[model samples]
Target chain A: EAGVTQSPTHLIKTRGQQATLRCSPISGHTSVYWYQQALGLGLQFLLWYDEGEERNRGNFPPRFSGRQFPNYSSELNVNALELEDSALYLCASSLGSGNVETQYFGPGTRLLVL
Target chain B: SQQGEEDPQALSIQEGENATMNCSYKTSINNLQWYRQNSGRGLVHLILIRSNEREKHSGRLRVTLDTSKKSSSLLITASRAADTASYFCATETWNTGNQFYFGTGTSLTVIP
Candidate 1:
C-alpha cells in the first residue's frame, strides 16, 4: 500500500502571510487527522475530518483551519502566520471510526515561518 | 489538555540492548497506540493495544497496556541502529470520537 502522502515537503512563509499544506490519505481510508509537531514538543492534535465532516479539533487557534475533500484528501490553512507557527505538520489516516483501526501517517509538511 | 505523558524525554542505548519507554494517560480510552518518527518525518504505527488486552508483540517490539493504572509501556528488544527514532504514545479516548491525543515523545538513539 502507498500509506499516506503530503505535498510541499517544506514551506517557507513570513509573519502575517498565509500558508497552505495538503495531505492525501491512503486508499480506502475515511478519516484524516492533522497534527503539529513543534520543535522540542510533541505532536499536537489539530483538526480531524472523517467522511468529509469536521470531527474534532485540538487547542489551536481559529487561523489554523482545514477541510477534507470528497476524495478524502485534506488541506491545512494557516492564516496570519506567526513565527511560533513554524513546525512539522503531519496528516494521518485510518480505516474507520471506533476501536477497530490504527492511524497511518504521512511524511508531513515542514512549515517554517519567519 | 494532552491525554498522554511520556517519560525519559530522551533515551540512548547500545545495539542488542533493551529500550523501554513508559506512558501515562488521564482519561478512559478505547485503545492506545505507539508510533515511531524518524527525524522530523511522519509517524509510523508500531503497535496497538486495546483496553481489554494486556500485551501485544510485533517483530522486536512488545507493548503492555494496563487499564487499571491507565498506563502503557513499550519495550524494544535486541535493538538495532535503525530503531533509533522518536516514539510517541497516543490515546483514543472513549466517547471522544476519533481524536487521538499524543504525548511529547521519547527520542531513542540506538548506538551500533
Candidate 2:
C-alpha cells in the first residue's frame, strides 16, 4: 500500500499571508494528525482529525487550523502567517481512534514565511 | 505542552556499535513509541511499547518502558550507517488518546 503523501513539498509566503498544506493518508486509515517542527520548538502536535471530526489540538494559536476530508485526507491552513511560522509541517495517519496503532508520516511541507 | 525530553541530544558512534537513547515524559501515557526521521523527511515508525508492557524487541531494536519513572529507552544494536537519523520518542497520554507529544529528538550519526 502507498504511504501517506503530502503536496507542495515546499511553500513560500510572506507575513500576513495564508498557507495551505495538503496530506493524503494511507488506504484504510481514518485518523490524520498534523505537526509543526519549528527550528527550536521541535515537533509539536498541531491537530488531530479522526473520522472527519476535530478530535484534539496542540498548543498552537488559532491561526493554525485544518480539516479532514471524507476520504481521510487532510488540509492544514495557517492564517496571518508570521516569520516564526516558517517550519516543516508534517502530516501523519493511523488506522483510527480508540486503539493503539502505528502512525505513518508524509514527507512534510516546508513553509517559509518572510 | 506535555512534550517529552530526550537525553544525549546527539550521538556519534562507529558501525557495529550499540546506540541507546532515553526519553522522559511528564504525564502518564498509554503507550510510548519511537520513530526515525532522515533529515527533513517524514518519520518512520520504529517500535511501540504499551504501558502494561516492560520490554519488547523487534529484529535489532529493543524498547523498554517504565511507567513508574515515566521514561523509556530505545536500543539499536549493531548499528549501521543507514541507521543514522534523528530518533524521537512520542507518547500517547491516557487523558488525550489521539494526541501524541513528541520529544526534541536525538540525532544519531553512525559512521562506517
Candidate 3:
C-alpha cells in the first residue's frame, strides 16, 4: 500500500500571502493530522480531522486551518503567512481515531515564507 | 507549547554502541509514541507504549514508560549510522482521539 503522500514538496510564499499544502492519506485510514515543524522547534500539532470533522486543534492561531475531505485527504491552509511560517508542514494518518494506533507520516511540504 | 521535553538535546555515539534518549511530559497520558525523522524528511513511527504498560520492544528498539514520573525512555541497541536522526516523543492524553503533543526531540548521530 502506498504511504501518506504530500504535494508541493517545497513552496515559497511572501509575507501576508496565503499557502495551501495538501496531503493524501493511506487507504483505509480515517484520521488525518497536520503538524508544523519549525526550524529548531518541536513538532506542533495544528489540527486533527476524523471522518471529515475537525476533531481537535492545537495552540496555533485561526490563521492556521485545514479540512479533511471525504476521501480522507487533507489540506492545510496558512493565511497571512509570516516569515516565521517557514517550516516543514507534515501530515500523518492513522487507522482510526484512537490513541493506540501508530501514525504514518508523509514526506511533508517545506514552506518558506519570505 | 510542547507537552513533552526530551533530555540531552543531542547525542553522538559510535556505530555498534547503544543510544538512549529520555522524554518527560507535563500531563498524564494514555500512551506515548516514539518517532524518527531524518534530516529534511518526515517522521516515521517507531513504537508505542501505553501508560499501563511498563516496557515494549520492537527489533533493536526498546521503550519504557513510567506514568508515575510521566516520562519515557527509548533505547536503541547496536546502533548504526542509518539510525542518525531526530527522535521525538509524542503523548496522547486520555480520551483524546488522534491528538498528540510532541517534545522538542533528541538529535542522535551514530558515527560509522
Candidate 4:
C-alpha cells in the first residue's frame, strides 16, 4: 500500500510571505498530523486532524495553521513566514485517532524561508 | 514542554556492535513509540510499547518501558551502516487526544 504523500518536495519562500504545503494520507486512514522538523531540533507536532476536524494543535503561533479536507488530505499554511520557519514539514496518517495505532509518515515538504 | 528527552545526544559505534539509547518523559502516557529518521527525511516508526507493557521486539530492535520512571530505551543489536540515523522517542499521553510529543533525538552513527 502507498504511504502518505506530500507535495512540493522542496519549497522556497521569502520572509513575510505565505506558504502552503499539502499532504494526502494513506488509503483508509482517517487521521492526518502535521509536524515541523527544524534543523538540530526534534519533530514538533503542529496540528492534528481527525475525521476532517481540527482536534488539537501544538505551541506554534496562530500564523501556523492548517485544515483537513473531506478526502482526508491536509494543507498547512504558514503566514508571515520568518526565516526561523524554514524546516522540513512532515505529514503522517493513522488508522484512527487512537493513541495505540501506528502512524505512517510522508517524505515531507522542505520549506526554506529566506 | 516536550514529553520525551533522549540521552547521549550522539553516539558512534562500529558495525556489528550493539547500540542503545534511552528516553525519559514527564507525563503519564498510554503508549510510547520509537522512530528513526535518516538525514533530513521523515521519521519511520520503529516500535511501540504500551504503558501496561514492559518490552517489545522487532527484528534487531528491542524496546523497554519503565512507567514508574517514565522512561524507555531502544536497543539495536548487530547494527549495520544503514541503521545509522537519528532515533527519537515520542509519547502519547492519556489526556493528549492521541497527539504525540517527541524528543530532541539521539544521533547514532555506525561506522564500517
In order of appearance, the predictions have TM-scores of 0.97, 0.97, 0.97, 0.98
Candidate 2, residues A8-104, lDDT tens digits: the string is 9999999999999999999999999999998644698999999999999888899999999999899999999999999999999999988577889
Q: How well is candidate 4 docked (DockQ)?
A: 0.84
The reply for model 2, stretches above 4 Å from the true place, is none
Model 3 docking tier (incorrect/acceptable/medium/high): high
Question: Compared with the true structure, what per-residue lDDT tens digits does model 4 show for residues A51-105?
Answer: 9999999999999999999999999999999999999999999998765978899
Leading candidate by TM-score: 4
Candidate 1: tens digits of C-alpha lDDT, residues A1-114: 898999999999999999999999999999999999899899999999999999899899999999999999999999999999999999999986766578899999999998
Docking class of 2: medium
Q: Write the per-residue lDDT of candidate 1 for residues B1-112, one digit (tens) a residue.
A: 7889998899999999999999999998999999999989989989989889999999999999998999999999999999999999999887887889999999999999
- Give candidate 3's root-mean-square deviation (CA, Å): 1.0
Q: Write the per-residue lDDT of candidate 2 for residues B37-97, one digit (tens) a residue.
A: 9987899999999999999999999999999999999999999999999999999888787
What value does the lDDT take at residue B111 in candidate 2?
98
TM-score quality measure for candidate 2: 0.97
Q: Candidate 4, residues B1-112: lDDT per residue as tens digits? A: 7989999899999999999999999989989999999998988999999999999999999999999999999999999999999999999998787799999999999999
Task: Give me the runs in candidate 3 sitting further than 4 Å from their true place.
Answer: none
DockQ of each: 0.81, 0.77, 0.84, 0.84
Better of 1 and 4 by DockQ: 4
TM-score, A chain, model 3:
0.98
Clashing pairs in 1: none
